[model samples]
Structures are given as C-alpha cells and as structure tokens.
Target: MHLLIAWCGFVGAWLLFAGPIYQAATELEEEGFERDAFSAQIDTVEVPERPSPWWWLLPPVGYVLQRRRQTEYRRRIMAVMTQDQLERMVAFANTATGWLFVAGGAFFIALKETWELAEVYELSVLLFVLAVVVMFALCALHTIVRLRGTHQMLARSGTARNRDSMTDEPPATSDA
Candidate 1:
C-alpha cells in the first residue's frame, strides 16, 4: 500500500511538473544549439521537478499509519514512561511526522524532473536553482521540526533511564 502510494506520487510528479519542464527544456535546447553540441554536453541546467500531486495524498495516509504506530509505541512506552512522558512522546512524533510524507513527495518529484534534464545546460541550471531554493527551504523547516521532536524524545528517554537507575540504586543503610 505504501509502495503504491509512493509510486503514484512518483508518476504523478513526473507527469505534472517534471515532464512539461523537461519537454520545454529539450525544445529550447534544440532551438539554438546544434544537436551534437547540446547532445554531447555532460550536464545541463534544469529546474527540479514539481513535487507529485499524489504526494498531497500522502499526508492523510501517513497520518493513519502514524496513528496506528502510535498505539504500538505507546504500548512499549507504557512500561517505562510516566503518563505525561508518553503523551509528550506521541505528540512529538506526531508533530514532525507530516514532513516525512512531504519530503518523500518532493524527493520523488524533484528526482523525476531532474533526472530527465540531465543534459540540457540552461534548463538544467534553472531547474537546479529553483530546486535548490525549494529543497533547502523544505529541508531547513523539516530539520528544525525534527530537532524539536528529538529533544522531546531525549527528555522522556532520560527521565525513563533515571527511573531505571534509581530502581537499581541500593538503599542507604544507617550506620549504628
């Protein structure tokens, strides 16, 4: 099911954003440059393919999956964490979970578009610039969210670990 969603995302992105841009780039290159001059060039400028429209669907699908996973994760945490800690863990994971789908969609979409324009210099350059800006923005935002989630996880983990260590601590006997 996940694979199907991913494939749909890949194909949709190719069809929608990457394909048209690539077609445009190819046609543009053919206009002025000689077939061999443009053809033989190892690399070309191009925009990153637009992310898959199907990728838009990923959010809901991923949400369902995360909710399912959350149940299991909570079960595991039950033994070690306080109720508050468990709540924090679920909330933290939930917050950044959406980005996974977003990134996946963007990656697949961008890859499809970029891969086709591998040789069109001007087109490739334009695509690359656009892709870099967009990708960087996506990545920077995702990273910040993930870091926050991680910090929350670490806090809970530390609390759990301390509880364990305390359990292991021997009683201090009074010296008579």
Candidate 2:
C-alpha cells in the first residue's frame, strides 16, 4: 500500500511538472505551424503515418510508431524555435530534471528509514549521488557554454573598440 501510494505521488508530481511544459511546447508548435514555419521543411521530413489500430496488437510495433511520431514532432518544434528560445527551454528542462532527482533521492531516503531496509538505504544513497552529479553536470555545462559565448562577444567588442580608437585623431598636448 505504501509503495502504491509512493508510486501515485511520483506520477502526480511528474504530471504537475510536465503538464505546463507540454502545453507550452504544443502551443509553440501550433503557432509555428500557423506561421508556415514548418511548411518548407515538411517535404524533407520523413513523417511516419499514423499506424493502423491493428498494429496496437503488436506492442513493439506500436511503441516504435509512437516513438517515431514523437521524434518527428519534436524535430518540427525544434526547427521552429530560435536559439535563445531553445536555450531557455533546455535550461527549464534541466532545472526540472534536477528537482525530480532531488525529490526521488529524498523519497528513497525516507522509504529506507521507514522500512529499515538495507537495500533501500543503498538505493537511496545511489539516488542522492545521481541527483548531485546530474545537477552539477547540467550547471557546469550551461555555465561553460554561456561563458564561452560571452568571452567571444567581449573579445570581438574589445577588438572593434581598439580599431576605432586607433583610427581616430590623437589627443592634443597642452603647452605649459
């Protein structure tokens, strides 16, 4: 019963986090389609046709079709998004993933303590470590990429400033 409750809670939390993101992405995709942003590339895309209902009898075939559809939809959405928008979406996703990991770790830790299970304790520790690693890795990657772009921008601006100053008239000297 406790395990079932925990599983339900996990699903609820996932829905809470994922629902808004999914809605936003869907809206964005619809807007993109309305603007004909995907029209030009539509021909180039290998969109999988909707599978027949009979195919659902074969679970593997159904799963593959579903995956293909999702992949194609994601591709279209990504193609429509600008770089800044994509980066923001990615950052949001990373934050959500980090939080989920932290929550999962906490859940496992609680479960271990409540049940006094050695295996659960080990699993809790593993989840905690995974949470830390994932959070750290995502943060590091974001910082590195952002810093690289900033450094390049600053370098270019500095070079331009130096060039402009060099081309300008020299300051006049004051005679005593």
Candidate 3:
C-alpha cells in the first residue's frame, strides 16, 4: 500500500516537472526550423537530410545516429555564426550542464537518504531509473533550447544584413 502510494506520488511529480520541459522543447524545435528556412533561402547552403523515423525502433543505435545528425547540423550552423554567438552558446551549455549535474547530485543524495530510512530496495531502484530518465530528458531539452537560441540569433543577423544591403543601394530611376 505504501509502495503504491509512493509510486503514484513520484509519477505525479515527474509529470508536473516534465510537462513544461517537454512543451518548451517542442516550441524551441519549431523555432529551430526557422534556421533551416533561412538556409534554404541561400543558394549555396546544403542542409543535411534528417534520419528516418524507423531508426527509432532500435533505441541505442537510433539515439547515437540522431545525435550524430544533430551534431552535424549544429556544426553547419556554427560554421557561419559569429564568435560572440558561439561563445554565448558555449557559455549556456556549460551553465546548463553544471546545473543538471548539481540537480542530479541532489536527487541522488535524497534518494540515498530515502532508501536508508525506508529500506525499500525495489522502490529505490525504480526511483533511480526514473531519475536517470528525467535527467537525460532535461539535458536534451536544454540542448534544444540552446540550439534554438543560436538559430534565432543567426536568423536575425541574416535579416538585418539583408535589410542593410537593401537600404544601401540607390533606387533605380527609370526614364519614361
């Protein structure tokens, strides 16, 4: 009875925490598409093809493959981005990673305390697994947010450049 109650509580809390992260990640992904659109507008930029959804049937392999594609895409973006923009992304990645580590550490410590007090090995292991899943999800979301921000910056810079160039040229006066 107690175990069931604990499980329910844990699940409820996980849902509450993960819901917003998932929503934010989805929004960021949509925003990231703008970067691809911007690239498409350029004549020489080559966008990489996305991996097939069928790859997801093989979990470990699929994850690695997806990550490789994402890294390659990010590298392409970074290639044209300014040093200041790159630095901002690096700093954000560092800070988000640090916070995740701290949060994971605190969660583990609390889990340990709970295990010692309750001696519920089954529940402890379950909690540990869930925590790992949550941590990884958070990390993925953070990466998405960071990349989205970079994409936004790049898109804005491109727009500003286009605007400047448009304004710089003298208007053509056609002689009737």
Residues 109-150, candidate 3, lDDT per residue (tens digit)?
A: 445444443444444667666665665576567657766788
Can you give the TM-score per candidate against the true fold?
0.29, 0.39, 0.38
Where does candidate 3 stray beyond 4 Å?
1-47, 54-64, 119-176
The candidates, ranked best first by TM-score, are: 2, 3, 1
Q: Put down candidate 1 lDDT per residue, 1-176, tens digits, no spaces.
A: 65555556545654454333333333333333333432333234232334445644789876666666666654543554556655654554454454444545655666754544433333566766675466455545554565567669989999999999988968889999
| Residue pairs of candidate 2 with colliding backbone atoms | none
lDDT of 1: 0.53
lDDT of 3: 0.61
- What shift in Å separates residue 151 of candidate 3 from its native position after superposition? 26
Clash count for each candidate, listed in order shown? 12, 0, 0
Error of 1 at 94 (Å): 1.2
Compared with the true structure, all predictions reach lDDT values of: 0.53, 0.58, 0.61
